[model samples]
Target: MLLATSNHLGHDIRSEKYNVRGTKYRTKHFLEFCIFLFFIYEIEDNLIQNTR
Candidate 1:
């Protein structure tokens, strides 16, 4: 019985670790996308200013 419980606990810990990693991966991608958008905005602003 104890062995079974330990096995279950191990599974839970592994899943939790995976969840944390997944969140980090998602956050990194999101930040990268935000940076890309900001870069585009800056380029557009510069173009508009040059045209003015």
Candidate 2:
């Protein structure tokens, strides 16, 4: 999850540096990252519950 977030942020930074209009792209990437994080959290929660 951290890697995914880092990759998205890196892409956004690269887009900004290249003078590409990045607002939309960044927003999309951020939303994707949030979704991925939520998925990871759910998986972790399930694992913890199963362990107990």
Candidate 3:
């Protein structure tokens, strides 16, 4: 996948493939995307505790 920065804040990120499921994934930075993988699962682990 080619990651291109569309702006200075790295907010406008896009992938090469366009899924037809109507899911538009976006990210603020490439680094965030790297950590996002784990974050997807963290909701069940720490999200409940961190919500308070």
Candidate 4:
């Protein structure tokens, strides 16, 4: 199962960076990506514990 949903966020960032009408503020992507990786790690940990 896919965990990170960065595709839409990535598109938004690109659009904002390129388009004139969108906001150009940046910083959340890295934060969100880290959080997502954390969740994936937690899930994997739980699965490993359950299998033991």
Per lDDT, the best of the predicted structures is: 1
Q: Over the stretch 1-52, how does candidate 3's per-residue lDDT look in tens digits? A: 2354345235423232344223443434556787887787787678778877
For model 4, state the Cα shift of residue 43 in Å. Answer: 0.2
| Tens-place lDDT digits, model 4, residues 1-52 | 1335587778878887677433232346667878999999999999999999
lDDT tens digits, residue span 1-52, model 1: 9999999999999999999999999999999999999999999999999999
Error of 3 at 39 (Å): 0.9
The positional error of residue 31 in candidate 2, measured at the CA in angstroms, is 0.2
Give the local distance difference test score of model 4.
0.75
Residue-wise C-alpha lDDT for candidate 2, range 1-52, written one tens digit per residue: 9999999999989978766656767888999999999999999999999999
Q: How well does candidate 2 match the true structure in TM-score terms?
A: 0.60
TM-score of 3: 0.22
In model 1, which runs have C-alpha deviations exceeding 4 angstroms? none
Superposed model 4: Cα runs more than 4 Å off: 1-25
TM-score quality measure for candidate 4: 0.51
> Ten consecutive residues with minimal summed lDDT in candidate 3?
12-21
- In model 1, the number of clashes is 0
> Which model is ahead, 1 or 4, in terms of lDDT?
1
Clashes of 3: 0
Q: What local lDDT score does residue 6 receive in model 3, on the 0 to 100 scale?
A: 41
TM-score-based ranking, best first?
A: 1, 2, 4, 3
Off-target runs (Cα >4 Å) in candidate 3 are: 1-28, 44-52
Q: List the residue pairs that clash in candidate 2.
A: none
Better of 2 and 4 by lDDT: 2
